[model samples]
Target chain A: GFAELLREWESLENEYQNTQETHQLYRQKLEEVSKLQESCVAAITRQRKRLKDMSPSIRKCKQTMTSEEANTMEEIQALIKERPNIFFEMEAFLPKKNGLYLRLVLGNVDITLLSKQSKFAYKDEYETFKLFITVILLLFAFTCQFLVSNRIVDVLFNFLLVWYYATLTIRESILISNGSRIKGWWVFHHYVSAVLSGVMLTWPNGKLYQMFRNQFLAYSFYQNFVHLLQYYYQSGCLYRLRALGERHNMDLTVAGFQSWMWRGLTFLLPFLFFGHFWQLYNGLCLFRMSQLPECTEWQVVMCGSSFLVLFMGNFFTTLTVVYHKFKK
Target chain B: GFAELLREWESLENEYQNTQETHQLYRQKLEEVSKLQESCVAAITRQRKRLKDMSPSIRKCKQTMTSEEANTMEEIQALIKERPNIFFEMEAFLPKKNGLYLRLVLGNVDITLLSKQSKFAYKDEYETFKLFITVILLLFAFTCQFLVSNRIVDVLFNFLLVWYYATLTIRESILISNGSRIKGWWVFHHYVSAVLSGVMLTWPNGKLYQMFRNQFLAYSFYQNFVHLLQYYYQSGCLYRLRALGERHNMDLTVAGFQSWMWRGLTFLLPFLFFGHFWQLYNGLCLFRMSQLPECTEWQVVMCGSSFLVLFMGNFFTTLTVVYHKFKK
Candidate 1:
């Protein structure tokens, strides 16, 4: 992205140099204005004399001049004096030199979103809000699943998942509408999660649910806990940056962000990797179940595969963004 | 987006004005160069004398001259002359009235991607390629279904659906890797479709499959036909624009694009609406079936709801993009 900006800058610089050279040439021409004006006057006088000689012969050939030709000679003389002056005036306004160069150079620079080096509006506040909600929701879900295991509890947690993610999708859309740095992929991630959770809520109680119930709850609990940790850490960094009046750098808190990386690498990433692998394991398990003669839970295979897609997508996206930011 | 460009241009102009004023000031100072040089020499001599006076006292306080004291007098004299020269050099390089103003203004102009007024990379080419493959695959499946109505044919179509959408997901990922404008929702869309088709392939031959079989194939047929028409028309416009040496304009051929709007509105949109409504009708049918006593195909309800989600997502996305392009 910076590559495009750099290229644009180079072109603008070249245009500026060209315009400066042109301006210097024009200035030189202006320096000899009196001499040029004298030459023009001489040329005009010569042309007038030639026309005068021709006019007498023409008048002899014709009967009389039409009314339209009454001021033809006088008008021609006036134009000779005025035309060059007007030409210079128009040329001065054009982008060849002076003020026009500014327009030419600036007009061509493409301003993109990623290249936006400006302070983002409501960036920290939005992140903080997101963190607050994530912490509350995750804490609630983690507690509900950890302490209690019932159909109602399962339903409640699923409802929370749907509501929280649906809310996230809405908030993210608003952020995007405001031109925040959140990518479309991140928003879609929430949409998928929302749909998945909604479907999970609708899943009928059966043998498949009985087998996978504890595993699913534990996986979700760990996920929420990791996310909760991340949100708080990120929020803290953002708040500190905002308080220090580094508003422009709210998104780039690298020093504090390193701590997040440390925590992730040492603690969260292993668990995330485990979860990713576990999703594949789940898929395999479902596939094996589909092969069993008595199993009627073939739909679990679809669920497992979608979960695999989500996990893989999440893992890859996280890695990419982290790599991108870290490299920067 | 051009609005952002105009704003940037205005700011650059303002900076140019400021630099111009600074350049005028510097030029005035340069005119009295000899006078300024004399004052600089006087100041250096005075500072050197003052340092010498403090040297003895500082030596008395310390055992020997520290590293800082070694170059005190000479460094002070050198710096007095050097500092102003360096300042002038730096200022000259900075944006200022005569020549440097361009550099200053251009350097500060921030170009962002969403704000990008520049030409995008060839995204349509990749999408066209994707559409081409989709059309071929869909047409093949449609033909197979029309000619043969056995369980094998059903499985064949399902397999085709799985493979095609999987390829789409992969291709979309590659496009995203290359920074095309394709969003995450589109990738997720393909992923969901791929998984759905996989599930459909796995669905057992039963009363349910028999009931939904013809409807699904017809839907697929119409969907592919609409997409094929759209892709060809769009690709033609892009190719023409490219041939005409309007590479940057390949994405923004609204004059040529109007033809697409006309076609979509008159011909393709009706079919698209029909398919969309049909998805809803399928959902309603599945819902009613779930309410019936003997019906055991609760999975259809999930299938139908997901279909509804997919349809709504597709419809909204198309509407949004069209509205955005039309508004532009």
Candidate 2:
């Protein structure tokens, strides 16, 4: 019995020692791998910098070159263009500096993507969050339109919008840092939306607010519906295109239209245009209210200007995208 | 001249091709390294699971063994205790699931630390942010006490506190995932603080609010000062201990006392105990206000209970830590 017990004990101890050794070996290998990743990232960054530095000189050299030299220059330009794609796969390992928005909000905290999976997961979360919030906002607007006329309820809704847009802007910036191809205007759009909602939140409960409140809620409902439509349609398009190897996986579904989304989405054009015009109508209504003799709140004029800006940005951007798609 | 031009073009072409090749080679290596990292992490996870599964069996085996076998069992237990340390350094490369708080707030977004530097940087940012916000809160409380008594201002101040605590909780969770050894009660304390601040934010502007506003603001001012003091002293002690190799580098400075912080930090006990008692005092005040005939807001009783909970949790935890340290 003693011999059997000792054998079992020895076996367990042997297993424990073996597991410890294996763990230590893997730990050491992981450390080496981490170091190698760091150096590889550094090398890639340095190479990118060198290519960037040489680009202007190459362009200047092209001006005076023979035809043969021009062909080489063109090849060099093409290579440079394709360079980022070659290294894009390793971006998660690269050292990233915080963009201005992140620096302002989160200080110098590094929000670099650690792996490709985390990046995609974050992007998906962003999409789901946008979709989910759009639904909630639509419902809130519906309630505000029909059920309650309380100023407190309106203020709460406006605060929610402000908070939502603020969070969206921050998340979008992080997505951008992780190589999401979100255009600059969409990010700017979220910032403006946050400011607009914040202004509405501070708008005093008075004649002008009441005059514009119903219209604003109705417009919000319509806008949210359009946003939901765009998200579903655009994400569907992106998914198909990504699957077919025609679109970047990092492409995001934007609030406004883009040229790449034109293949089979013609039926959705009318809704987008109508929403844009509704924004224009809102701007006009607010401008009218701002001129009223009883209008004392600066929020009225501010909101009016913001609406006009949104209308112009959305309408023109959508128009440009459509025109370019037709021309192509 | 033509030959020289050809030569220059060829040299540039060569450089471009060489850069491209180097990039490709490094990219391939990085991919392999990433794969290695994944497998290594998987292995570590598997090993940890195995050890955990074997733990109960080992304990059972210990009770029925001879004295020599018991000594062997003790060795196994000690090895198990030390195994986590061996693998701790590789945690950044490990797959981390979202904690409950992060899951509820941010969905399933991955907040894993990618490297040691980022973890330390994020920890430092958290400390600096806390320090910065504490100063701002202290000033706001001072203004609320002597300079301003407007309900709107008070509401804004309370909202800031709510936002601050909410953010701190999220950041602290991230830090915890990155291997910081912050105790559980501190995180729970922030949750309670966020709730308290939110309840204060929603308390209506009324006679009861007016009665408690000054006292709350005064308590806030003192609490912030004590927080600032604890931050400075605790961080100083942690810094010394960490440098001396006597403390884990990921240790955080908490709002209340910790056992390891007893050396040369006896002076801070009064301030911490005073703050804890002040929470009790606030709880009592709010209870009195809630009992008044004119009081109708649910916020009063809710805030009273929250303050009492916070006081009890803080006082008992600190007392236990102190008692254990002195016994040692």
Candidate 3:
């Protein structure tokens, strides 16, 4: 019985929709006829008024209201009464003009888009998906890096870090020549935002932070590593410039070289100083841990390992720069 | 008698200096004349060879070398025997063809210097000096940040980091547009030594590394912070594009908005998720420390204080973004 009632109700809804649509069509036709009748009657009336003042011969011709004219006037009146107002038509739906300013300022997205024929960025949805997947996997690689404990893992990870840093620096140099010199101010701005975001994510009231707090150091380290890579990038670029200049029998670009140096210095100096103090503290921490009977071998290993990696990376990077110059 | 001998020795040294300078000048003149004479001879010889190989009339005339020509030839031979070959005249040290190429490839740098000027970057002198100063200072700051015993200092220093990062990013973006739109690549390539000179600072190794190895986390934070800021910058630009589209009744730009959102998502999501984990770890450390008997008041206060600053700053930034979004 319930099924029958539901079916009946659905049928009723369909019937109602059909009836409403038919009624609307009828009303629209009626409105159109009424409007036509009204316009005809108004025209005839205006002619009758003019007929009152016109000469008799002219009046006998155009002034005489024929039955056809009377019929047309009646049709106009009927149409006017049945139809909707002209102004009420979907006039608001039409596009408005914000004038020439918008046209000048904005690019036509349709023109610029990477559709079937056009090639621009953000096209190839498949590629985006693949890129995103790769990025996710990379993030996972970062995760495994911190979570695991082994000498091979440690060595491999730091090596990877160096590689990543070197590649990024190289990329940046390429960009610098290409005119994508990321300046000091921009880096500073992004740094502030990232720190703030980290804090926000970790806020006590937030669930995200509730699951992740102590990892701040590690996470921050990874982040800073990327940043350092960027720094080296600009530096390495300048390095190439010097080398290329020599090859071409040109004097080194003294001024441009210096500017890159300044920007790079600002980034490196603070980080190096921070790392220096950390080394001292880390050494002290390891020493203090030694006195504690509860200290585990793993704790000592972590301390010893991080310190070694940190120092080695910094030392070799500096030495590389010097050695490169000497080699040159 | 010893004083008299010393005076005589000094007089001999002065006389020697004068004689040496005179000899050097004479040698330079002889070298110049000889080189010039050789080039002239080569040019004349080549011309004579070509003429001799050509119609006999020209060859016969060449055989009867003029008295003036013979005189020039004799003078050139004498000087060539006495002097060394120099490529171009010293006044224009660079060969004319190569100099013109360098001038066209790069702006005039001989007259323009790396100094306080309208240079795209800090001039060369300031660059090296600034880089040296900042790197040392940055190493200091990085080290200090790790101490984590002063809340106010951490916040203040982070703020400074933010400012620098911002400057860097802005410069980078401008470089991109400049490089592509105008022939600014030439300027950058010429001035910056093809963008390589600005990146890695070569230095004596151990000192720089030993100084910077300690405070890895702080440096890492600064780096991550910059990436987050990039996320915001990309998003903000897209948001404005959306606004313009809506205002101008152009629905096509909605695609642009989608792509921008996609970009920001890729940019920030990693940091956000990674940061989420760190925040939790920090909390655990903070909480555990609070319960520990060995925790110093300074350590507790500074750590707690750093958290508060980060939290507040993040909250305000979120609020700023939200408020602007909904406000008329």
Candidate 4:
């Protein structure tokens, strides 16, 4: 019996020792892997610094060149202009530095996309959120237009718009930081939209508010419809282009048209122009309202100016994109 | 002139080739590093699975053993209970899966901390945010109590509280996903606080609202003061413990007391207990108001119940933690 007990103790000891050894091995391997990862990250940081330095050095070098030298270096100039894309591609594994907006809100939290899959996944989520919110906003605008006369309901809808655009701006910034080729104006457009909705939210329920409410809701409904249509068409185009190696996979379905979106999406142009004109109409209405003796709220003037700016930005950007595409 | 042009071209060509080769080498190294990172991640995932399996196998083995055999395996059972800590340490470099709240809100975005420094930095940021908001809330409450009685002002203050708690819950969830050892109840407390603030925001400017408004503001002011004090003390204690290697660096400063917070924090007990009782008093006041004939708002009863829940949770958790610490 004593010998049997001793044997049992030895077996348990062997199992315990094996478990400890395995744990030790795992810990050691994890430590080494982490060290390698740190070195790799440091290498990336160093490379990014060099690339950043390269731009300034190239610019300085160009300034020292003669006119003839500059002419001869035209190809180099073009390549330098395309350096940002190359930098983005090379820094795919590096942790992204937050933009000013994100730094202000999230306080420099690391919002890096460590893998291509994760970056793509985040971009897809942004698209889905946009699509989902657009549908809800469309339905809500419809209800506010036809079924609801209550100020509370209108306030709720405006609040949703404000929140939606705010979220969109944040998501878009994250996408851009992850190497999404979203142009600057599109990101700025969301900030303007957010401010417009916020002003709308603060507008008091009065005769002036009542006068413009229906038209505003109607415009929102129509705009959301156009957005839905654009989303479908642009996403389909994007999918095709991505598969054919013609577009970056992270390219988003923006609110306004870009030159690249001209192919097979001409049918959506009329609707976009109509929405743009409606924005102008809204601006004109607000401007008239702000001039009225009874209009005392600063929100009236602010909303008018915001709408005018949005109209000009959207209209001109779309026109330029179309004109460029037509010229080509 | 032709000779000079040829020399320039040749120099440019050499520079371009050097740049290209350097980029190619960097790309190759990056590729290799990422592959290694992926394999390391895979190994961690497998190890986690095996560790998970070990628990069940140990349980099954214990069930099949005689009482004497089970008695002999007590040390192994203890080690099994400590496995979660080991697993967390091992998986520090792995991407974290979102908790349910984050999944519902952010939809499975990767919130992984790839380095220990980032994790600690995030935790510090969270503490700073809490402190900053606590001060703002305290000042806002004081103003509402002494300087302003406008319903709009009250609504704004309540909105700030709701937004603050909502943000805290989201950030706390992120911290938990990143392996901060925040207890579950503390996260749930923020959710309840958010709901409470939301209810308060919806309460109309009526007789019942006026009845509870000053008391609520006073309580908020006092609670925020206690939070500020607790933050300073807890963070100091954490800093010391971290320096002494007695605490994890990622541990956060929570609102309520914990067993580990008992040493050198006995003076904070009275303030905490008083805050708990103040919650109970607020709950009782709301319950009494809700029973009045003029109480028509559903928010009164809801606020009453929420306050009661907060009181009970805070009181019991603190009591149990203190009791445990005393026994130890």
Of the candidates shown, which would achieve the greatest DockQ relative to the real structure? 2
- Could you tell me how far off, in angstroms, the CA of residue A52 lies in candidate 2 after the best superposition? 5.0
Per-residue C-alpha lDDT of model 4 across residues B112-152, encoded as one tens digit per residue: 76566777777788788889889899989989999978876
Ranking by lDDT: 2, 4, 1, 3
* Fnat for every candidate: 0.05, 0.06, 0.00, 0.06
Better of 2 and 4 by TM-score: 2
Name the docking class for model 3. Answer: incorrect
**Candidate 2 versus the native: TM-score?**
0.79
lDDT of 3 by residue, B1-328 (tens): 3233335435534644453444344335434533543444344344334323433433343456777655644553454333222111111111121133222212121221111122223222222332443464455466565565443343344434433332233233223322212233323322222111111111111332233223324534543464445435544653465365432223554666646655765676456545534543443455555566654333333343344344344445444544644342
The residue-by-residue lDDT of candidate 2 on A129-235, one tens digit each, is: 88998999998999999998887688679768866886777788877777777778888888889778866765656677788888899999999998888888877
Worst ten in a row by lDDT for model 2 chain A: A249-258
Query: Tens digits of per-residue lDDT for model 4 on A1-328?
Result: 3334435446644654554555555445545545544554555455456445555555566766778777766765575566557656755655566777766445556676755667767766777777898999999998888887886687678767866776677777877777777767778888899778866765666789889988999899999999889888767765665555545533345413344456545789899989989999899999998889998767788888898998999989888877865664
In the order shown, the candidates' DockQ scores are 0.03, 0.22, 0.00, 0.20
Estimate, for each residue in B201-228, the C-alpha lDDT of model 1 and write its tens digit. 5445677767777777777777787778
- Candidate 3 chain B lDDT trough over 10 residues, lowest sum: B195-204
lDDT on C-alpha atoms for all candidate structures: 0.53, 0.74, 0.37, 0.72
- The CAPRI quality class of candidate 2 comes to incorrect
Please provide, for model 2 over B1-328, each residue's C-alpha lDDT reduced to its tens digit, 9 standing for 90 to 100.
4355446546655765665555556556656555665666666777688678767777676667889878876776787787788677566545477787565455564566655556666777888788999999999999989998886688678768866886777788878877887878888999899778866766656788888888899899999999898888767765665455444533345313344466445878999999999999999989988888998777789899999999999999889877865664
> Candidate 4, which CAPRI tier?
incorrect
